[model samples]
Target: MFLKNAWYVAGWDSELVGDALLARRLLGTNVVFYRGEDGTPVALEDRCCHRLAPLSHGQREGNCVRCMYHGLLFDATGRCVDVPGQERISDKLRVRSYPLVERDHLLWIWMGEPSLADPAQIHDSHWHDAPGWTAERGGYIHYKSNVHLITDNLLDFSHLAFVHNKSIGTRKQGGVKPEVTFSEESVSVRFTTIEGAPPPFARQLSKLPDLVDRFNFYVWNIRGNYFAQDSVIAPPGDGYGSQSPLAMKLHTFIALTPADEGSSHYFWSTAHNDFTTDIVDVTRQLTAQVTAAFEEDRNIIEAQQRSIDASPGAPMIAIAADGTLLRIRRMVDGMAAAEQARPVEQTLVFQPAARV
Candidate 1:
């Protein structure tokens, strides 16, 4: 159900420490992520070859992880380096190592063919390592709903009117139709509100006039599963920032990884270029507000998931506001279908507990 050839966010740059092992499930496979002694990121199958124990449960020995169940040591490359009781370690005694790269303060991993894993394919987000932008990252939430359900909720902004009425949206901005456009690599959904009042969260940045222009843009990379939302509120303007004095921008990047078919791991962060020296504190406050709004969404989405699970045959009726969501669903369905139809030799089926 996932696009295997793409890079998915394994964790934040700060999550993996030199002496700690982080275990995360991506695309239904359990994987362990850690930083080596030299501060390089490494990703390997979480399960050990011997006794099928989780490597993350074992302790780190030097640069390698020694299986706690049997004292088998595996290196960053997933090769069996030492076995306490055996004189000769079998070459087949190892786990699969995934290609991992650190970019934009996030660790991304590839789950498909090693030959096709390219670091250049990682998607970039605005305000990530930007000159004047301040970002608050390392925030995550687990959802009981499918990953696509969250994607559907994100692609359509109409829900913001009700879901986030107290924080970022008002009834005035919900009815506006987004100008949707697509390219070979990505899809853009944009909504513009002119002469509208700023939301509660934006008001915290600065004092503004009664009516301002608000712009919300969502850019989705179809193949890579990367999504970014750029929100700009400015003086009733020509475009982006014609009036620099009264402009504020908040950018959010969402990394969605399927923990399994029924659940997902969602990571997000917010950034802005409002205050220079105090930007970090400003971003932190903004992040907390957004987190509260996300909790509201989490409650709703999880309840919806429960309903779907209770009624397996229930059908959802899509409305006009669901245009972007439906298109994305169709694209995902097509990709999953194509992957299923491919020849067995062309696909690398990864079993979560299997040894390399």
Candidate 2:
């Protein structure tokens, strides 16, 4: 149901603290996140082996966590270091630790085999740390639907005409041609001929008084599930691709991490080169408006999930605009199927319970 070897966004860097435990479920597994004494992010299986108590319920002691149930202490590597009642610690007494890497103001975790958890395999979000780009830290959204639904909503922008009409989209965006480009590891959906009155977000951000030319670009990296959309608007000339300085661009970063089979944790961040403290208040207001528009999306997708659940065998059709979405689904399903077909090694060997 999920790509286990891929890197999933656990949470924003600002969301985790050295003293607090952030309990979250990823890829149908219960995991806990926190910062160590050196301020390094750490991820571990939330279940404690002794009584199966959630380690997140315990208190943080230095870089280790002390289970509240029996006062068992666990280190950052998920190793049981101390037990008040006993001095002998078995080597097998430990919780599974996930490899975590902190970059681009986000914490990413590898939920697969420990040996394959290489930090170098993580994807990069250049805009998050690039110079001259002001990165706005948009917070996460809890979606009560499958992760695929959210990805579908993002890859296809045709729905924006009606779904986000009052926010960042207009009716003019519906009938435009989407140029779909594909590669082995990435897919891009581009709309280069969008020309019409500025949407609410473009109007506020661009401060343009008349109709404008626009360019919308959406890209999906298949491996890490990092999705991005670039919206550019300007006067009736070439789009941002022509290096037009008059164009106003907003880059939105979105990544999805499965909380189970039916729910997900949405991580978002946006960067805009146009930063004006004079209009900072306006930007703040625009942020709230955009968040509300996304909530509108949340409602519709959740309703769709419910409908599907109610009618398990209902038939649904896809239109021409779903080209990119179909490609993404194919890629993801292939990855999951391949992972399932591979043999899993048994970490513990049993010889008829030691001939008992």
Candidate 3:
């Protein structure tokens, strides 16, 4: 049920340090990750070739993993290199090794053809490391709901009216009809509120007039990436001083990776280009606010998942606000379908675990 050929964020780049083995289930496969001697990340199937023992529970000997169960050792390439008693290793004694790359503190893995794995295809989250931007540390979260449910929530911000009433959005802003546009790889939605009150979060950034102008834009891709740009400014004649923070800008980045049919992984962070403020303290406060906002969303999405489970046969009614969400669903469904229709020879099929 997942797009295996696509790149998925396995975890943080710093997570796999000093022979640490991070085992994660992505797209229904149990994969183990570790940092090699060269500090490069390596992903291998979690199950050991012999006795099906979990290699994640094994010890790392240099760049190879030694199965604590029977002393079977596997290299970073997932090839069986040593056996406790046997001198010769079978050519088939190996586990599937996935292509993994580390960039911008994120570890991305490719589960399909290793030949087609390209680092350029990975989403550019460079803003996390960009100059003049203060970004909070990246958050690696888990959700008990399907990836699509989370995507649906991210693609439609109209829920901000009722869902995030206390934090980031107002009723009028939620009611505003965004200009929705589609591209080959993503969908974009944008809207602006003139002479409207800023969200509660914006008030923390600066003392401004009761009324402000707000511009919001969001883009979502089928690979489960969401990029948002939000700007708020006080009226020009409001007599807000130069020292008074009158303008606020925020950028949010989110990436989703399906864990299985019932759960998903979330990688996110928020960055701002407010040089006038104390970036260190502002980032801390912003991180807390953004975390609270997402927690609210998490509660709602989990509740929706329970509701969906209760009424699996019922069809959801799409409203005018569902324009972007619906388009996202279409694109995801189309890509998944296309992947399934590809030639059989190009598909990766696994052999049965040999009983040793």
lDDT, candidates in the order shown? 0.80, 0.78, 0.76
lDDT of 3 by residue, 181-285 (tens): 888777787777777887887677555567877767777666534454544355544422222354666778788888899998998877876634434477778
The number of the candidate with the highest lDDT is 1
Candidate order by lDDT, decreasing, is: 1, 2, 3
- Per-model TM-score on C-alpha atoms: 0.92, 0.92, 0.90
Q: Give the alpha carbon lDDT tens digit for every residue of 55-110 in model 1.
A: 99987766678888989998888889899978999988988888888877888888
The pairs that clash in candidate 1 are none
Which runs in model 3 stand beyond 4 Å of their true positions?
Answer: 224-245, 275-280, 344-356
lDDT of 3: 0.76
**Positional deviation of 226 in candidate 3, in angstroms?**
4.8
Q: Worst 10-residue stretch by lDDT in candidate 2?
A: 347-356
Q: What is the C-alpha RMSD of each candidate to the true structure, in Å?
A: 3.6, 5.5, 4.8
lDDT of 2 by residue, 300-346 (tens): 99999999999999987977777667877898898789888887656
Error of 2 at 101 (Å): 0.5
Show model 1 residue runs off by greater than 4 Å.
275-281, 344-356
